[model samples]
Target: MKEFRAAVEAGDFEGLGELLAEDVVFRSPVAFKPYEGKPIVAAILRGVGRVFTEFRYVRELADADGGGSALVFETVVDGVSVNGIDLIRTNDAGLVSELTVMVRPLSGANALATAMSAQFDQIVAEASGASS
Candidate 1:
């Protein structure tokens, strides 16, 4: 998960993409369905980059076998204070196979949902464009 942290901290979206499995799954805190596949997940991450401000990871808890991890983070969305955790799991190839995001405070989550909703079209476009 060191690579994941480095990529996020550096704001390196391409690097982040390289760390994902082709069939990676993303579970969002506000979404009902889990988004699957690398392209969509990468696009979602990019959309998140646009929505969140002052994002920073505060702590990390990893399995001793390096199979999974939980990264604690803090950020702000439209001035709403947000606390979150990124639950990541790796596949046999050592690339991220699954990522589940959990956020706290109803206000913060609502703010995030609203902000992401505004960019949903653009995110889908990017994912489709990337696939094409």
Candidate 2:
């Protein structure tokens, strides 16, 4: 989990690419859509980059299911500090197959929602271009 957290905080898509399944699925809190496949995975990160700057992790819990894990992160965006939780599942090869995220404080959810919505659009645009 630390490895994945490091890769995500550093925005290292290449390193992350090596740790995700080819048929991976990423689910964001906003829009309720899941991004599937590696290309879309990269796009997901690209979209997040636009909103978050100082993404420092704070607390982490070991795998809840005895294998899959939960991670907590604190990030600064637009000068607001937000905490987020991630539930991740891995494949037999230790590559991430599924991911789900939850952010704290329902009050600030709107901005996070807006940012994630833009991120989804950006990822879809990128995916469309790649597919074309």
Candidate 3:
């Protein structure tokens, strides 16, 4: 989680992509569909980099489930803070294969939720382009 957080907070998409399994899937409450594969993950991370000025991983709990982990973090957007958790599952090869993220703001959960949305279209567009 720390390594992944470092790459993400640094906006190192290239390096981040290298960390994912090709069949990776990222899920969130805001989106009905899982953000499938690396392209979609990159797009969402791109949008996250745009919305959050600062993102840091705080805590993590691991080795507790069917080969999965949970990561907690704080992100700052326009100076306000928000908390997020990523429930991630990895394949037997130890490569991350799935991620489910839940984010709540300290002072602006609703606004953050709205803003966090409105990016699915971009995600879809990126995924489409990648598949082409």
Candidate with maximal lDDT: 1
lDDT of 1 by residue, 36-111 (tens): 9998999889889889889999999999998999999999999999999999999999999999999999999999
Clashing pairs in 2: none
Computed on alpha carbons, the lDDT of every model, listed in order, comes to: 0.92, 0.74, 0.72
TM-score ranking from best to worst? 1, 2, 3
Looking at model 3, which ten-residue stretch has the lowest summed lDDT?
A: 105-114
TM-score of each: 0.95, 0.81, 0.77
**In candidate 2, where is summed lDDT lowest over 10 consecutive residues?**
123-132
Each candidate's clash count = 0, 0, 0
Query: What TM-score does structure 3 among the candidates reach?
Result: 0.77
What does candidate 2's lDDT look like per residue over 1-132, in tens digits?
Answer: 667888887877556767778898988766577878977886776667668777876777886555688888877666666788888888887888888878766644567777767566667887566532
lDDT of 3 by residue, 17-130 (tens): 777888899886466777778877867766676677667777879875557878888877656788888887888876778888887753645546567676657756866675
Global lDDT for candidate 3?
0.72
